[model samples]
Target chain A: MSQMEIKNITKKFADVTALDNVTLKLEENKIYGLLGRNGAGKTTLLNLITNRIFPTDGEILVDGESVIENDSALSKLYFMTENNYYPEHMTVKKAFTWTKGFYTDFDIEYASELCEKFSLKLSQKIKTLSTGYTSIFKMILALSCNVPFVLLDEPVLGLDANHRDLFYKELLKNYSEKPKTIIISTHLIEEAAEIIEDVIIIKSGKLILKESVESVLSQGYAITGSISAVDSFTAGKNVLGADTIGGLKSAYILGHLDKSGIPEGLEVTKPDLQKLFIHMTNR
Target chain B: MSQMEIKNITKKFADVTALDNVTLKLEENKIYGLLGRNGAGKTTLLNLITNRIFPTDGEILVDGESVIENDSALSKLYFMTENNYYPEHMTVKKAFTWTKGFYTDFDIEYASELCEKFSLKLSQKIKTLSTGYTSIFKMILALSCNVPFVLLDEPVLGLDANHRDLFYKELLKNYSEKPKTIIISTHLIEEAAEIIEDVIIIKSGKLILKESVESVLSQGYAITGSISAVDSFTAGKNVLGADTIGGLKSAYILGHLDKSGIPEGLEVTKPDLQKLFIHMTNR
Candidate 1:
């Protein structure tokens, strides 16, 4: 069964149409990447799914049941946003205690272990932690909740490389031990590309692509060669992006090419996630 | 002449040794990635060079002359930090007008162009701008400053993918047209790898590696093959990171490997900058 499904979701904020007829089906036990430019409705869609805000028109289902204000359905999901809205006076320990009441699967021991990994002070008030520490705290809570579905929106905003790596490792380890449906909404596409099983691209409140990682990556190729040769090679092909230096030119084409006919000294390589993202959104 | 130099730099915050006798030289007309773990003194070092804070024991020279409170030396550099502290009532245009007097090379036209590209309103008060817009305002000003050395600390923090791509393209275009030294401190290593000429890796408030980008990437290789063959091949190698799925295993090894005796189903590849960073810093 699908973990979560959004049918023809639409949301409007005054004059802005934040989401327009967006439909998505999130499967079970998979890591999905919800990628889009800022203000592209990724956050709005997430909010709608988590029921932080009601959709203007359409239905959101968690395990085939409407999730809006449904305690049982909401309890099965955990959403960690970019910013924290915890009470200012709540300490880390107190926050966990509160979360334990809401989430039956909350693991105190795991939360403490995560706190140690993040170097968080349990005695310190939630408002007192640094931005990075706050993020780590939220992440720990999200992971320890053990919900069937978890939604993380730009969770690594303030984290450095070491912390990000640790988070990814911990996430994978947790997923392996207890598989769950996870959706990560982020602009850092390349960083999360390897970890995500599926990619969902949103542009101006519309879905662009939703497919497996391998299939998405296989759709484009980067080729470099002499200006004339490169131009000729890309002449009839769908060129996504192009860069030139002196007499050399490189173009990222949106389809495969016959590698054997490439000119000498030219190189053809697979396009990275970042290149593909730029190619798709920059237009 | 070196663009910037630090000799025996030391800084302390109470009992914490933020920087320990660090020394380095930055050449002109190159982009250097100043990367390190959080609180590893990357910001402290940038502060010392820009004269924002005095090092407890150190000497920072710009063109062979001490830059401590020297207007002539300070005028040659510009630092765009993660946060801006503008007056609540200050509009984008007002801030630019005030900044123009401080730098002789400030270009008003270019700044306006950048503001337009970023969709920023010059008449909007600073406090009214979104986090991303505020960053764009500061970045535009920094680029317009036309200093011999420009330092950016997480300049693209809240920016989307499209804006980031635009920023990179504009930065490279500006550099190619005017050739200046640029230092960027960011956690997005792979995204900036292509644009950066040199890299400086710091760990625990100490320099780990300061080398050209080519030299750094050349030191590692990623090998993928059958689980058994990959395991055997990487048995004695310094593995930075490893991942296994089904019968396939990919290992990020620290050094070049002899490919002649490789297994039948194995594939060798170059290590990406992010993987290299995680491997180096996680250790």
Candidate 2:
């Protein structure tokens, strides 16, 4: 199994610290969710791992080998972001052919099949595509790269509902067959909550969480009841936030519940991923 | 009361039909969800209403007045799209001041307050902002324009979960305080479903469905049971699709559901909007 280790990495952009003393370990054959607010250094961390930008401190090691100036280690990783570096007039088909020159394992047949599924025209120029189609084109290339570790930042940036559904289903199918390591960075937490096995959260350039989705859900929960009942039950408890509508209220708590200590008319449920994220990241 | 009418509009680009003989009416103090697949002519419809492009057939009117080349009628409408028309060097603060030139009712103080709420720096140039921040800036402008009809095309594009939550909450607050016509075009159906009173779905440059969210949801259902049981239940029904996981199955169906007719060990629920949309638009 392949393993990547980020050890005490810190990145500084001029005087501003984009990442600070962050450490993580990613194992192969697992899908991870990289969750954070804007300017939370998620992109900076990805850049450091790919050696596109050197970290100010510490290092990244893939299979116990330093990734810096190492082409062999870098070749196994593919990072796809929103930025487009291809020529403005390059056709989608031509871009697919060009990608084959760098990545020997690029599957042109699979890409063509994906194009048909997405209803994307192969003859269309990259610059002429809409925002949603632009994301789709980049996603197709990333998926067909056949790399072990694929870093997808906002893969569904501008996709419509139907397209988003198709992409997620296709991704799960690919992972089940290939068993590769994948990390998705996206803002659509509720939609992505199901497929992502583990979540890594950052706040203000510091790692705040690294846990399995199951464990995270088990640790926290939401309680709903009358406003007064919820207030009394949440007294001195680790409350995240609460929403009240007329006589009813729902309070989010970041701790386990004792099932024996129950109140009538109160409902218990799993904590929402997006709600927890907002509560944890808010100042 | 304020109203806008779209009268038998059809837009054609060469031999291809961009929008085909569509008609709809918008009333004041209502929130509408405009939904469609990419290249399905949602943008074309918005452009036609704003008079950025004239329809090949028919016309658009605001309060019974032709919108084509009518500045007085157009002033009541504010369109916020992905495209940036501001000068590259113009900062967010400068853009707010410049908007006052065209919109006499543009609220500079409210725009400044919104910038703070969304954590947007006023001094940042429009060209230098990130994709998420660009959307935020445009949204702030549209909200503060004090217009009767506000059209937002993918306003939450590229925003993080926290920012999206904030934007929706702010939008609701803004609407409650000042009752105006608001149309939101987004792919995040589940998130937007709660706020939008009605949904308008377009497919292949044609309006497929336009109705209240409640009515649309009420008309369809989903049944879940064992594979054999689900198959038997969905047989000869208006089955949209079905999924099989191990021995369990779930089938999505259109038309009214007979709850009492469900077999033992079967569960039924309302249809999912995204699933309904996918089934409607798929070839």
Candidate with best DockQ: 2
RMSD of each: 3.7, 2.7
Q: Estimate the TM-score of every prediction.
A: 0.89, 0.92
- The alpha-carbon interface RMSD of model 2 comes to 1.2
Cα error of candidate 2 at position A261, Å = 3.6
Q: Can you write out model 2's per-residue Cα lDDT over B92-178, one digit (the tens) per residue?
A: 999999999999999999999999998899999999988899999999999999999999999998888888888998999999998
After superposition, which runs of candidate 2 have C-alpha atoms over 4 Å from their true positions?
A87-89, A223-236, A241-251, A262-269, B224-237, B241-250, B263-267
**lDDT digits (tens) for residues B1-283 of candidate 1:** 4488889899899999999889899998889999988788899999899898998897999998888999989998999987677898999998888898788679988888998888888899989887788778888988999889999998888888878888988999899998899999998887789799999987777887899889878888888988778888888778877777777888888776677977778898887787788777774
Q: Which candidate ranks first by lDDT, i.e. highest?
A: 2
DockQ of each: 0.62, 0.76
Per-model fnat list: 0.77, 0.87
Candidate whose TM-score is highest? 2
